[model samples]
Target chain A: MIHALRISLAIIALSLLASCTPTTGTKIAVNQSEISKIKSIGVLVKKDEDFSVRLSREEMSNTGAAFGLIGVGIEAAVRRSSDKDKEEQIKPSLGNFDPQAPLTERLRFHLQEGAIATSEVTDGGEKTAADAILEVTVRQWGLRRCPGPAPEVVQAGFNVNGKLYRASGHATVWEREELYLNGDCRPWSMFRSEELANDILPRALDALATKLVYEILYP
Target chain B: MKRLIRHFIFALALGLVLSACVFSNANVNLAYKPVEGSKSPLSTVKPLKIALVVEDQRPIAERESIGNKRNGYGSVTAQVKSNSDVLTVFSDALKTELGNNGHTVVADKEPLYDVMLRVQLKRYWTDSVIHFWDVELVGTINSDFVLGKRDGDKPILSQPGQGTFRESRQFVTDSAYENVLNGALSEFVRNFSRDPNIIKALQQAGQTATPM
Candidate 1:
């Protein structure tokens, strides 16, 4: 009986470990020659909304209520408190975390790395003196639960949509949407969601910017 | 048999803890000073008071992964920092070199100069990769330069002159990385001052009077 109990526990732990493993998916296309022709590029980011995690208490409560939970209101309240605790723990490290700044910087770095000059351009503002302009729209960002069990494993990811335009004629030269995922099974990830977001989000952005530059320069 | 199993488990836990402590943060400054005693070929071509336009749009801090990854363990990363404005540093370095070589370098809105020298930074970083026995540091600096008259936007030397400098060094310490960067900067100064096209532009600017 003792041997059987130990084997059962080991199997359960192994299964949980497998479920928490992270995975990524991406699709990108570009015209290498046209992108390489651009000598100096200006970057502009659209500020649509603040970044928020997808699997928040509000989203979960809505889903629970849709499924007609027995005590939906109380359950939501509990989840909200739990998430608030996690947020408080992550608040110290997040010193003025402007989601747009990091993404813009990464894009500029990669552009310069490819021997192309870069400058910042305002959206709907005066035209810059660059050969081409890159417009970025951050569609989705934050930490969310990966598809799995009740104690669902969480992952940090973001979706970036970018369009490159010729400065002279404002014609779309190259376009791509990149999705990045970093699903490492961190210890106590649920309780440290904010910390995980702070750590992995920049890495995801770096990976996305690298891919974008590769597609544009090398196709 | 039970004692052996307990000891094995204890050793495995100790190894995991030790592996977790392998990662560390390294702060690196990218600031470099101008190399003294450099000769400029345009020194004898007559002094031309030129407006120096230097624009830097690079990030102040850059983070990158440093170590190679193991099968079950992840790679160690480092956050490289530039405490000072890198653009300003490069600009100042160029200005000092020009001033030392008997040329007037001004950074102002006045249109009193003969021509405008615009230097735009493209890429500046120290990339490190772990080799079999040591780490290799590659320092790179790339910029786009345009020397043109104040009245028109067209470049006098050419459309835009591109200058790139790279230097590599093998080291285990972070300070050696800075030396590599300084070497690249010194190379840039030497190449920019000796370019034949740039000398021709300076000579033309010195011959022509101020535009009305």
Candidate 2:
């Protein structure tokens, strides 16, 4: 009886292990009817602070165990210092590098391509006008040497939270937090660091916004 | 049950204390730092023109993340991964090391070459699992290497190398992990460099080699 019980438990354990599998992402949610109503969107970007490039989080290290909160406090400070080091490394590349103008331009271009009229709307939601509002908060965006599967490999990354709402009724039609790195992909070379910072990073982010808008408005 | 719960709590606290600087889901840059005192074998060997090919056979998930600080129930609290592709980094390192040993490492497969070596990574991973005030940082690499003539016939030599490192640590650091991973890779590749069979094969192949 005990042997049978053991065999039964082993089968159950094997079944549990075999059942573990990773699922791919679902197809983009397309509400065709809702998208049809969103003919025009006013892009509202919430940028209150300066866009500064920082190193990937793993670059920061607190190498030892913390004792009694004080150690934790010191390690935090050191880690912050390491975190801020990349901005200085890329200072030469940051010559007037701004993502705002280009991001809006790309949005307009994509939205128009999607056949939805698009315009820039300032913070005063009540004052300005478009059919709907596409408010985006760029949670994180910029270029850095990717925290690697290889070191000093340049990669541009972005995480954006977006919401599309009707201006008249303010009903949320679409909302999503989109974007992340899939692998330590090397899309650019080190010698082109300047081009990446000045041109590629901004362009990459513009496309990110454009893709989000593409998904929402194009169904 | 109470004692188990108490131990779990202690483990959680210790984990938090140890991983105070850990960045969850972060990629670590395993930059090229040569392993110290790793040159092995006292046998004299001839340097021959070599071709190197490295295949990474680790699962996609292992390629992405090798280690995690998981909750007792097995949810990841923190994760670590290599900042770059493993194949490229490992291949480049092996190539450089070969070059250092006076061997010309090349990409060409023409009859001009002597021996072509293929290194397949069977398993490569690292982890820092915390439990009951014990923090263990572990790095492992298992490799299968084969050496054959430029004729691409039967292989002259085939061997396996495994490198592992585990240490009780206060925490896992970027530098510490880098060193351990490098050590594991160095040790794995040393099988090719340090093995007498491989050495004798390379020398004999060199003597008969007709490089154009």
lDDT of 1 by residue, A1-219 (tens): 999999999977765454311111112334556765789989887656544444455234233333343344555667767755655655445556666888789889988987899999888425799998888887766554443233534555566677888888888887755444444433334434445446666776666566566546643
State which candidate has the highest DockQ: 2
| lDDT for each residue of candidate 2 in B2-94, tens digit (9 for 90 to 100) | 999999999999988866655356566664454443333212446677788888877677766766654332245676678887778778877
Candidate 1 lDDT score relative to the true structure: 0.58
- Worst 10-residue stretch by lDDT in candidate 2 chain B? B35-44
Predicted complexes: DockQ each:
0.02, 0.02
Pairs of residues at least 3 apart in sequence or in different chains that clash in candidate 1: none
Supply the TM-score of chain A against the true chain A for every candidate structure. Answer: 0.64, 0.69
Q: Pick the candidate with the highest lDDT.
A: 2
Global lDDT of each model? 0.58, 0.60
Query: Which ranges of candidate 2 are over 4 A from the true structure?
Result: A1-30, A59-73, A144-147, A180-193, B1-212
Q: Kindly list the per-residue Cα lDDT of model 2 for residues A1-219, writing each as its tens digit.
A: 999999999977765554312111112344667777667789887653444444444342323232433443455566557645655665566677666667777777777876888889887466556878877766766544443255545456555667777788787777755442212235333523576556667656654655565456433
